[model samples]
Target chain A: MTAYKGYLIDLDGTVYRGKEIIPEAVEFVSSLKEQNLPYLFVTNNSSETPESVAQKLQNMGIPCETKHVFTSSMATASYLTEQREKQSAYVIGEDGIQKALEQAGITYEEDQPGFVVMGIDRSITYEKLAKAALAVRNGARFIATNKDVSLPSERGLLPGNGSFVSVISLSTGVEPTVIGKPESIIVEQALERINLSKEEVLMVGDNYDTDILAGINGGIDTLMVHTGVTTAEQLKEKQEQPTHVVSSLKEWKI
Target chain B: MTAYKGYLIDLDGTVYRGKEIIPEAVEFVSSLKEQNLPYLFVTNNSSETPESVAQKLQNMGIPCETKHVFTSSMATASYLTEQREKQSAYVIGEDGIQKALEQAGITYEEDQPGFVVMGIDRSITYEKLAKAALAVRNGARFIATNKDVSLPSERGLLPGNGSFVSVISLSTGVEPTVIGKPESIIVEQALERINLSKEEVLMVGDNYDTDILAGINGGIDTLMVHTGVTTAEQLKEKQEQPTHVVSSLKEWKI
Candidate 1:
């Protein structure tokens, strides 16, 4: 296997599953660190800040720092900055997305905004959704961090950011530009952050839909690990196969 | 013009626009009352109870009582009762839907419900949506009050009950059985309430999509008024025209 210049890793299913970290994934990241290979944890989670995410990973005994994490919020902010010079957004999300917008110098406005950015907001209210719909109808560019319809939780699969985003899109009859896994926007942005070309970077993750498909969509090689959502049998049904498939991250040669 | 035995009248646009009552519609209702024709105001609004809707109409000098009003809430409750003898629902909406479910003897359960009823909830939170989505995914029958994507408000067009309903439907990959206008369920239920057959009743409203389409879908006659959302010019684009179109309700003879 050809050695890649840099790696784009996925969180949740790839590195850890909920509260538990995959042992093989942990060892793989350690190897990357020992070899001094550049890598970034690319995640679609727009709720938690990079610091919080890094802290969780570090506590799990994984080698990670705030700079090593790149969330969908950061990608969305960077995308907005590239899309327009004057960035004012009516944002519906939690801390991570808000912080990213602030750090990117995007002002939050209620009435008339240049962009209507939607993320998974646990404190979502009708008034917030109403304001967003109105703004989008008034010709604001609609942008969503991800298009994940459901999120797996202890209780059950709950409505995700994509489901909430449908309210504005369905109501206003305007589709949003999604910027998460499987869309290629977040992967492209992550590659830019790592300062590596797509050809030189390999995207590694457990999920075939979000992680592997993201790499394929972004014109990069993908390494699929079977520790999460997609099983080996399910991968066979897919028309376009991943670049490489392994039982675990430990099986892949760096 | 045939003197209909009963009338399924619309609120918002046909009877009133916001807080102000349309004078021609007021006189039209008065004529119905004087001629001893049975009438019920059928609205897609599931937030307010029949009593509240009647109070608003009475305050505007329109002849109406609690019995003369039938909201989407009532229709949804009626549909559920007819569908299942022992119905237990996890409802997400306001006072109107809650009261209707209670009146219909449908118990509200969270953990495992037989049905997941979604309506217009202004105070909608992610927790409520999560619960509804989980319940629907767990084999609960998904039901929505209406499919009106947007509602016209003073603040402009806002996300309606249908948009919120999309969250649960989208997350669970289930299409809800809509019980409001354009679905024929509400109109059929309203016909039962008025004790009139579809041929004997004339559905009257201002919106071509909801009111007129409900009548058409229910196999009944319709009277479209030009005092609300659908202008006469806009109505021309529709392939299936309303049975009757008028500049004002006053122009039609009882």
Candidate 2:
């Protein structure tokens, strides 16, 4: 396929897995550097903020700065801050979520919250869920980091933060407005951060629904790769396909 | 307020805009028609089959199609079609996508599509869109129909199906999987054709989103009172709510 403009690369399955970046990942990024083509690490994983992701990437020998990275957590925080305007938010997640909220100038409240935010909190307990649900029931705006159903692991897969979001959603019947990958907040942020337009970017990833669809939803061309989650067999057998298909982002020319 | 297991009432700006439902709405739903109430509506908005939604209603709504009454396009179709055959499908939506395809004895394909199905064609486009997007791209499953975007007039909304679908999403996505309300193939169809479920249904109509949200997304809470899109003044102040809130579903609730 002809190279379009810049790139919007996925992080989890596309570049790295947990602490270890995938083989050829650095070179793939270096190629973008050589081309001076702007690329952003777009991830639906709301557990980590951009700064943390940048630090992680830097630790792994990938020369990425916080500016070149984006997370759904940032989008959720921005959207909530813009709309709710400094509301007192009760958060159940990680340092990433806390930092995002604080940076956005939102106050953190545990009870009678004006906002109830949920991220990928492994330490989630029924009590925490009750508190969060109670806050939402009492009129706090429910915000979720991301809705990824499963987190990729070397052990195959683990219940993602979405499972917890669902738990809270069940406790309180209000479905949180998901503002992640497929929802366009992250992509919108990426475009703004990189000074790029929809037509000037292409999204490359393995997941058909999340990564590829995010690009499509954000009004960009999408290339689906068969590196993770979706096997070649599934792609071949499935009816709906992406705008383009590749074996890996390593094979990407742009 | 004591929580009861009756009536899985919708909370989207209906009873509550963000913080709380209208006081009347809260009271009305709280004081339900019955107490042994376990009323569940299959609501996922997108990507879920009603069977899954019905199963996941927690303690909200009763999932039985017999005594209880709730409807979704998926549930409506499921009740209509019992044959376990895969018909061709050309869908413009998420995966719960295949539900209607399954019901109509249709299989979903992208390449050699048979039918051109469209429901709320969220992924709409222009020119070369309707002809190819749904039927060819997703594998034309069936020529479906859906025209509820402009429900019963007086909803004071913008032009709905006049373009949103036929021009924007539908015209580009494909013809449709189904269209129109009260059609034997639509929400009303399931109610009339199937001897199960409650008939004490109200064809609620709010502008576009509210009407469709309550109707096809899950269950027929079809309250389309002209509150939202009529004047900025209406939506500006969220006081005048709906029980059933469209101006011209044209029935006096009293």
| Best by the lDDT measure | 1
Model 1 chain A lDDT-worst window of ten: A78-87
- How would you encode candidate 1's per-residue C-alpha lDDT over B1-254 as one tens digit per residue? 88689999999988998998999988999999999999999999999999999999999999999999999999999999988534999999999999999999999999789999999988899999988988888889999999889988888889988888889888889999999998899999999999998889999999998999999999999999999999988999999999999999889988
Candidate 2 residue A244 C-alpha distance from true site, Å:
2.0
Cα lDDT for residue A82, model 1?
95
Error of 2 at B4 (Å): 28
Q: Which pairs clash in model 1?
A: none
Every model's DockQ:
0.86, 0.02
Backbone clashes under 3 angstroms, per model? 0, 61
What lDDT does the true structure give each of the candidates? 0.93, 0.57
Worst 10 residues of 2 chain B by lDDT: B151-160
- Poorly placed runs, candidate 1 (over 4 Å): none
Give candidate 1's error at residue A192 in angstroms.
1.1
Chain B TM-score by candidate, in order shown: 0.98, 0.46
The CA lDDT at B141 in model 2 is 36
- The TM-score measured for candidate 1 stands at 0.96
Candidate 1 displacement at residue B37 in angstroms: 1.1
User: Would you give me the overall lDDT of model 2?
Assistant: 0.57
Which tens-of-lDDT digit does each residue in A1-254 have in candidate 1?
87899999998888899899899989999999999999999999999999999999999999999999999999999999998535899999999999999999999998779999999999999889988998898888999999999988998789999999999999999999999998999998998899999889999988898999999999999999899889999999999999999999888989
